[model samples]
Target chain A: MSTYSVSDTTAPAAPRAALTFSNLSGRYGVGLAASLVWLAFGLSCLYWPDLGDWSRTGSLGIGAIVIAAFILFGTFSADYLGSAGQALRKRAPWLLAFGAFVTLWEVATAKFAWLPLPFFPPPQSILEVYTDDLPKLLDSVFASIKLQLGGYIIGATVGFITGVSIGWSQKIGYWVHPVLRFIGPLPATAWLPIAFFTFPSSWSASTFLIALATGFPVTVLTWSGVASVSSAYYDVARTLGAKPSFLVLKVAIPAALPHVFVGLFMGLGSSFAVLVVAEMIGVKAGLGWYLQWAQGWAAYANMYAALIVMSLLCSGAITLLFRTRDRLLVWQKGVVKW
Target chain B: MVVQSAAEAIIYPAVGAELDIDGVSHAFDIDGATLPVLDNVNLSIAPGEFVALLGPSGCGKSTLLRLVAGLEKPRTGSLREDEVRITGPHPSRVVVFQDPTLFPWRSVWDNVALGLEAQGILKTQRHRVDAVIELVGLSSFRNAYPHQLSGGMAQRVALARALVNDPKILVLDEPLGKLDSLTRIAMQAELVALWQRKGFTTLLVTHDVEEALVLANRVIVLSDRPARIKADIAVARPYPRHRGDPYLADLRKQILGLLGLEATW
Candidate 1:
């Protein structure tokens, strides 16, 4: 009756909104600027008389690749400053940059053999290698995705479910908690030999490794989540005569979801990181395996391309998972609706 | 009107004979020494009686309220509601605490509806939520969160939540003790209006002598720790009783004198 009025939510717009071209302008412009400076530096370095051990051409090619990586990262990070807009920063500029730079790279390497390798292919030849052997690359990519899917599913699901169960009640916690505390701290790769020996199959080994990697965090997050509900809330629920199952389903799970999802995102990322490394060990089909194979014979540019593709896939998966979290917790964005 | 209210009070002298606390006593160990809380307390509150237990802090006033709400049990004597021994918390008896205690995660409407939802009357219970929201003057802020509300509004939300459950008895554990004077006075006025309309039995615990005198038909005063009922005086004042009224002033002086804090007042 004597109630004061309450105000509505006032969620501030994030500084960098989705798909804004502001980051590209920053990342690429800064990158281009750095590349120009580096180019000048390399040209200046080329005139040194004592630079006979390493040829100027090879040094320039390697320096260009390293500078590109540095400048790309630099420009990209700066793009987020005025990042509030939602329009797709136009991709044409990025595409043109990628194309023109790569073409120059290919011509320099192929025509002049700027950076030569005995048993390995240069990037120009490697670009043609794709045209000549698209089937091989596709096969490897497909095999990797397939392995990743199975391993990711097994690892994430069991980890999440078991984590929640262990977190929710003391009984399971007593049984599983201490064991996980010790075992969970060990790196996932440590389990590879054991898994490979037990399973006798490369896929199972990778899946086991991946599950081991991601499961520990989920269990810990879920444990913390379930423990975090205010005892006052439990009293309220109990006073209301809620069943144990109802309490868990309604009060416990909903309260724990934000934490649970955080664990899930971490697990998803770990799975990607472990994917390539796992493949190179036992399996023959993932991006990791392809990178290793390309690197084996000193195919530096080919190795770099494979690395780039792997990075794209990894980033894409992570982005998708985060978007899923956004969809689930859109309310957390401070946009509450009546 | 005084004669009529007096007659009505006589007819239902005790809380219509529903709730009974029999010879209850409690204690807490402070500094490795046992300190008495409530001793030989015997009272019965029937349906629809708004009683205020007024006392100083450590007088076991809130402890007694908690006993009645079934949040705590007395060691010496049994407590009963409608002749049935009270044990754990029951939704039929809801409590409004001094602090707002509104769930931060829940919206205003959601917080109000939580008790009812817990009662399992969720779907097709439109009237319950709407009526309670209207009762508290928070229909406009039904979707607002506790963090977004002023302290006064949040307290009202807490009251609405208890009321929505249609509890047989409402317990106020120093519900308005934390409020500033202006807001507290306004809230007291509003409380009387709502109580008259709803007719739910209430037990308000407070240290404010004026508040106890204002809201309650009978204000039960208790002595300091190892509390005993010092006095039980029936009030004849009507709603919106003026602070400047000579009668209220005399009563205030009388209470302060009784509390042995006459020099301070």
Candidate 2:
């Protein structure tokens, strides 16, 4: 707390100048250098004759603008953004590397045509596909979202309740657990023929397929979570005057939530896989159906575009799940590194 | 049904129940082998008295505390409170274990309010949660989760949780043994202070002789396996008793002698 005067300590060394861009050398300035290279590549793409059927000037111009924006925003507002800005600045080099990759990809496929045909379509072809089929793509996206949500909700809920009941009572567990174990390892897709025959419509059949895929992991993990709850917790709750219901609902369920989240993540992954296959079976309008239609026509560009969308959608669902886990398990804060 | 408020039901400044252990004996079947834990452990604790059950580690001190807490019924005898036999665990008596065992999902305040909520009185007695949190010096961390607390802080939350229920008897099973030395000393003082203020009948099971001497009015020393009361020495000293007092020094020596250990001090 106390500050002491430095009594003219030792001989005063030569005064150093301020830390300016002149002093910032080597890797410290790599981000700026990379951005310049990206800009130069973008400029060349505009003037050079294209070997591809489509002109890539617009998309290349957009990419250059984005890189410029990042450079300007990162340099000027790095102070205002505080820690987030610092993080962005640290990751700037990765963006530069990505830009280099994009430049190489553009040259090889679009301008030079060095890669094989159809298999390696240029970035512009993918962009062209997005521009041409935006409306149909939107429709498929919504359809996929609806199917995934309905199936996931039904599966996760039923799985959670079943898991909790099985975990809570030995009598119920004795009958159900072994049955679940036998059925669990069998692939959900193995039920595809039965599901098609049993359901009245293709919609219901597809939904069942997704649900079956999602439910297994959730049920197994939730069962393990509930079963593994410490007896100490029950004892404490009992001594505190908790009833059977309170012990199960409040104590057991909450204590087992972390495990339940793990199950949800696994379920989400399998559900997506099942969703695609189910759509390919009988579904009319979804990313999976679109992929099938695109492949049948040999519109590889559209297939690539749909694959990107599917990947984004699936990752978005997973990100949402992670956020929910983070929110609910506030007590596990700082214990798990992201 | 007409319900009486907590204030009207519990008599403050002297709320503890008289505990009567009628020749209680208990054992556990460890892999089909009957392991004797306690042997005819007859003891009677007066109302509002502080009694410490002292024995070596693995001597069934915790088992005795559990029995008194009504978590486990004794094999051979009945344990009573205020002339009524204890059938099962009741909120009237609460146990604070050495591990704190605070629920990881709940915040400090919610953990303390658990008993009140269980008894269906939380809606009416919500204010006691803050009061108890403050009592345990966890007011600043009322909303903080259990994982966020230090060992000492977590133990305080456990203490607050037990106290919030206005329990008639407080059974502590070496609650402060896991803490660091400095925290242990501070918590011993805090425990005595709380007992004096709340006037709950305290049955503390501990292995530390100095802790028993410092906290309890009557220290009941027990022998090794199949724990039976070897000596029940009553300390006539008042609250805030001196650690270096000659009387406490002599008592510690005698307790050590009974435990088959030399008085190294």
Candidate 3:
């Protein structure tokens, strides 16, 4: 590795970088510009109804604008990488188009007051409603997320350790799998009545529901991950002089990571949904409780705000999870793969 | 017990001498019936010898390797290292499987270090990983993930993993079978180079007769299912032998002949 040869190697990197960035910019720029135009068009339709309405004769311009914004967002995000070799990337454009169509319908009902009633609230009103409860919305958001995260960690920790132990041992898998399968599919809600009678505290009842619901998914997923580890891995481990404990921890567990994470993500989602119901059932202060309270007071605006907070928190969690998966699995991304 | 006794009956052929395997046989319960997988197979590999077990699919060639590695116990006969019966996998015996079973989560160094780590080698001895990776010509990929490596690289990583423990014997089960033709050939040559450098007694099981002929000092051809050693052809070719060598082709046909496209029952 002489300096001259090193320089020779380094020189080629510039061209590679140039080519990659040029492709990236060329792809994303078009989508960005298209999105800007959508925003403009949407704004005009709202302000001056005569000019920008594409989907319906009379629709609020704001609804159209939101639709366009989301369309552009999806299109750009989906296309940035280029050539995923899968159908999802190909179908993304259509998905964005459909979203746009839905937005147009929403606008038409509210803006022009077409088919007026409780059927379709104006998109503008929904936005205002969301904004009105921003303070309380933040409160409920924190409250629900706090409970959800607590339950998820406890349930996932117990479930994963148990599941892996069970899966790695045939005798254990045989003993536990049948019992778990019978109990797992029983809905989280079904136990709510029993929990109400047994647990003295409403918070305990809510936490228990969250844990039970989330644990089933996490346990099932962990078992699947552990079971699906390749036979060759075991052979390699065996030949390498690994002890049984070494084999389980080193080979089986790491190989089962992606599957275990899938369970964690699913469990998180279910527990969140369950928490909302539990919060509304008896106790107060959580997002579900506040949502019910707002609805009872007929504060539609505040209710919408709480809903927005819920969406943001859930999507935020999903983004964090996907980012973690992507980072850990960098080798399986575009250039290098499974 | 039969297998162990059979191996015990034979000398390891002498110190630093060939491993003598005699009358090894095995069967598995397939659908509640005892299905014979190998029967009365005997072969010997001189110390530092490269012997490829050539056979068709389901011929129990892999089963034979697993038995040697102590991952499987044969029903009759035995496997031994230095005249001692091999009862379980130990750091002294390492195996490379067909799929290049490098742990996806570990880097190349960690994978290579796995064998030593299992033997309770101190963390200070971890530096030995670099030497093995270099022997495999995988120095550049030492930090790479299994998922990031090409098929050939993965197999090389697997070999490095096996060799880093400084095993007395190396067993490879179709280790290069997953690579494409060109990579397979390239890997075959690399394998021979590594064997010569490390000087570990090697036993490779493969479907490719030509690969066996090119690399092995002794090429053992097995009969179809319930496999037996049908032919034990001695390849007198030198190390780094070219595929174009004429004598190598002669040995290839002899191995193919033992496979018997027989009209004979």
Candidate 4:
């Protein structure tokens, strides 16, 4: 049995040794192919005459060529280029797919006019929005960040405190649980009409809606986290002469943190939906407002640009939250994989 | 063997406290039905004595240990340590539970430092934490988290955590119950050495009759649930006693018989 088991383990090693050289080349070959695809895309953008007027076609072509050059360089020197080159090499297949997709989009929209004119502007037209409408886009980005941060901070703090209170004390739970049950399930957008009427400004109303959206999940999850802490933990702390405050702050809070992060992730997702909806409905500025304005003016290129920016911002925020969760819950690393 | 040198590095003053369980009875409410656990149990433990409670599983020996630890209140009677009533858990009396119950988030050092930290004396008395961890021979694993430890190592950390408090009485609820036999034997020797060195009134609950005979100076056998004290037999053996000694084997048989099991071996 031992001999058989030893052979079973060594079986995979034989193939691994034989395939090492080819595997390395195969991995880098994907990056090489991806760069060639991007090179073809850039050349097509430069040579293909557009059926419609596209201003930043040259800039788009240059950008694609620059990307192709980077990928080609990275594929050849991945070993020396450290982590960045490794990341580029890893993403080579996706980049190749993206290059193909953009080439098709440009051909259909600009060169051939197969899709439509006003609706599906070429990729260069979206790039034109970035180049031409820089100031307004920058303003919208800042406005959205400020509003979202303010709402998120307020919502997270209040939710955490309320959750701890409800979880700790029966009296608080008795009073708040019913209210939470009543209000928590309703979408924050449903409060749009009343919030606008109640608050002084559309900005404040929008902030309130975002806060409401973020708070419910945070409260519920945090409460559950605190409530579900093993009674044995409390006993251990108490026997060690830990006071009520110490038990809550040190024991309960740290134990409940993983759940709190889950809540934060959920809250952040819901807040994005609320933020965009609120911006579209009433707010004067934000990516959502930019998108609405672009649509109204029949500037589909600008709308696409705003959408790209919105997705990047939302995904970036989630990544940052995950990073923080990873750091705080390092002890829980292998126990629960994100 | 590592514990011998570590034990010499620290010496505890004989601060063992007398425990008095005056007609203590306890019960639990399960599905609105009152279930009796311990029935009018009374025992007096002298200062610095190692006593082990031997019983069948679910015989309320653990419940009695909890009462001594001041983790739970008795339904009908009072428990006292050195003539003072044990109303709630305090640093003077600490417990090592069956599962080792070390906070999963804290490292071994931090877990051991808990009692002092809870008492707000960790900053000044950090050496106590280091000493206890060393005593348990887990100094190398001071920075290691609970999950990273094997069952024995984690149990050692739990012991260190309790010992850091310098408790007047140590309540162990089947502390070595889950360990494998080899590790259990080694830890049993280690526990005896620790108990002798520290001189803390130790109350250990276990179903292992031979274990009770080998470790405790006195073995108290209890009957099944609403556990009544059946017999309290004193093992007048000297330290570094042999496990293969016929005296211990005979006592083990007697205790097992008391627990309603024939010593077939």
C-alpha local distance difference test of each model: 0.71, 0.84, 0.73, 0.88
Residue B29 lDDT, candidate 1, scale 0-100: 81
Best by TM-score: 4
Candidate 1 C-alpha lDDT tens digits along B38-100: 999888776777898988887888788778878788989988877889997887778888877
* TM-score against native, each model: 0.73, 0.91, 0.76, 0.94
The native-contact fractions of the candidates, in order shown, are: 0.22, 0.66, 0.61, 0.70
Give every prediction's interface RMSD.
5.9, 8.6, 5.9, 9.2
Please give the DockQ score of every candidate, comma-separated: 0.25, 0.42, 0.32, 0.47
User: What tens-digit string does per-residue lDDT give for candidate 4 at A63-162?
Assistant: 9999999988888777667678668878889998999999888888888889978898899999999999999999999999999998998888889988
| Model 2 lDDT per residue over A1-338, tens place | 11122355555432443446763454336556656667766765676677757755578667776776677566446556666766776877877787777777778877777887677876778888888889999999999999989999999998998899898989999998888989877877787788888999877888877887788888888999999999989888899998999999889999999989989989998889888888887788799999999999988889999999999999888888888888888778663533
Q: Which residue pairs in candidate 4 have backbone atoms (N, alpha carbon, C) closer than 3 angstroms, thus clashing? A: none
Error (Å) of candidate 1 at residue B118 is 2.1
Better of 2 and 3 by DockQ: 2
Which parts of model 4 have CA positions greater than 4 angstroms off? A1-27, A335-338, B2-11, B263-265
Each model's chain A TM-score: 0.66, 0.88, 0.67, 0.91
lDDT of 3 by residue, A23-75 (tens): 54564444454455556546644554432223332344565567566655655
Better of 3 and 4 by lDDT: 4
Tell me the tens digit of each residue's lDDT in model 1 across A10-94: 5565454344577445534545554555454444334433212222344555565566455545445444534321121344255
Which of 2 and 3 is ahead in lDDT?
Answer: 2
